[model samples]
Target: MKAVTIRTFGGPEGLAVIDVPVPAPAAGQVLIRNEAIGVGGVDAVIRRGTLAMYGFEEGHIPGSEVAGTVTAVGDGVDASWVGRRVWAFTGVGGGYVEHAIAAVEEVFPLPADLSAVDAVTLGSSGMVAHFGLAHAHFAPGESVLVRGAGGSLGIMTVQLAAHGGAGAVAVTTSSAERGDRLRKLGATHVLDRSGQGGGADAPAGYDVIIDIIAGADMPSFFAKLNPNGRMVAVGAVGGRPPADFGMAMMAAFQKSMSFATFSAATVSEPDRRAVRTAQFDAASRGELRTVVHELLPLEQAALAHRKMDAGEVFGRIVLTP
Candidate 1:
């Protein structure tokens, strides 16, 4: 089997594809003949050694989600699972190869109509977006704003909130071209984010704000929330927000506004499963669309990482082995 590994993590150049032995499924696990791999922002963070506590090694595979067919099942797994097409959360960072292993509890069978590309693309980002909408305290007919709306999670947030009955959906993107696409996806308003400084006025007073860019944009975004409105900061892609981020909240004290951050990384198993199931159901019904920016071969993991790090990928990047 071939897998992508990062021994000395720093840049995309260090993401190396190498031959490795196929891993066998242990108890409660299934072996997948992986057809597609989901590349996400967290994968990039792990690759950069920013979260070095994860203890990635020379042969550490760097993917988390995969869509594939089950070739075999380990002890305690149902024999009927073999040959079933499914999308799963790999136990470790081992989803980057031709074959992957996942715990049975982490696997979800995919409908025949779902392509592996779509399945992988809908993995983690979709889950986060689904849950973040709740953290926004979303309500039907309310105005919503999705910051960093060009990214995978942000894009889904825009779609879900739009479809969930938001009266007006707004999005912030780096280009007018990107904003135009977002408008087609359901955004009623598109704000050009390129060269737009933090705290820039962006048509204020949204009822719910989904912020994935929590750096310089925090203050302005925090101040724009309507009275009793909620802002959910899901990512810090631009960089960490300033330490005194509460200043905006203090100023908005009269509004009774609230700000919270969510990460699927810290979610419990049951909660993760519930959100993923809801996302899959929405995808199956065509209510939620999974967008794929690019599909590359497994060996091009480095290129995928580079594009992701540069914020050039508009949607999820799938890797085929």
Candidate 2:
């Protein structure tokens, strides 16, 4: 088998493709012949060694989600899974390969109408967007603002909010053209990356903020939340905010606003699986959308990381093996 690994940590050049022995499934696991792999900001963070504290290191394969066909099942697994097309979560590594292993419990059956590219796009990201909104207690007709609305997660948040009955769906993006693109995706208003609302038509405050970037600017976005609003920070792609950032929330004590960080890990496995399966079904039935920026070969993993670092990718970049 061939796989991409981080030979060294720093630039995209650090990712090198190498030959390796094919791995077999273990107890409660399944072997998948990967057709597509997802690349996102977290991959770049891992490549840069930002997550080294979490056990990432040299020679680590960096990928989280994949869509493929199950070639075999391990002990305690059902034979019916073999030869089934499905989406799998390969943990934090071992996904950038021709064949990957996933726990049987982490694999979800795919709709025949969904392509491999679409499966990878909506599989993991859709789960986060869906659960994040629910965790924030978003209600119908409430206003939504998605910070860093350029990746798969942000794109899904915009569509879900609008389809779920948000009165206004606003996004903070890099350009007018991308904002225009998001509007077509159901965004009601656009804001620049600096936190400036698009125009006078923009909502003065948001009822719910689904923020993907949590850096120095996070506090500013927190301030935009309406009284009694909830803000959920799901990703820290822009880096961590200052240690004193929470003080801003305390200062607005009278507004009764709330802030908290959200991770899929906080959700029960059964709940996550159910939500993911429903999202895949929705996309297959045309009730949801998956935005893919480009498709690259598995060998071009380095190129994919470079694009992500340059902020050139609008949605997801799928690597076909």
Which lDDT values do the candidates have, in the order given? 0.83, 0.93
Evaluate residue 84 in candidate 2 and report its C-alpha lDDT on the 0 to 100 scale.
Answer: 95
Each prediction's TM-score against the native?
0.91, 0.98
Error of 2 at 184 (Å): 0.9
lDDT of candidate 1 over 186-238, digit per residue (tens):
88787756323224444467888888877765777776678898989898777
Worst 10 residues of 2 by lDDT: 194-203
Give the candidate number with the greatest lDDT: 2
Task: Tell me the deviation in Å of residue 281 in model 2.
Answer: 1.1
Q: What would the TM-score be for candidate 1 when compared with the true structure?
A: 0.91
Q: Where does candidate 2 stray beyond 4 Å?
A: none
The prediction achieving the highest TM-score against the true structure is 2
- Model 2, residue 274: displacement in angstroms? 1.5
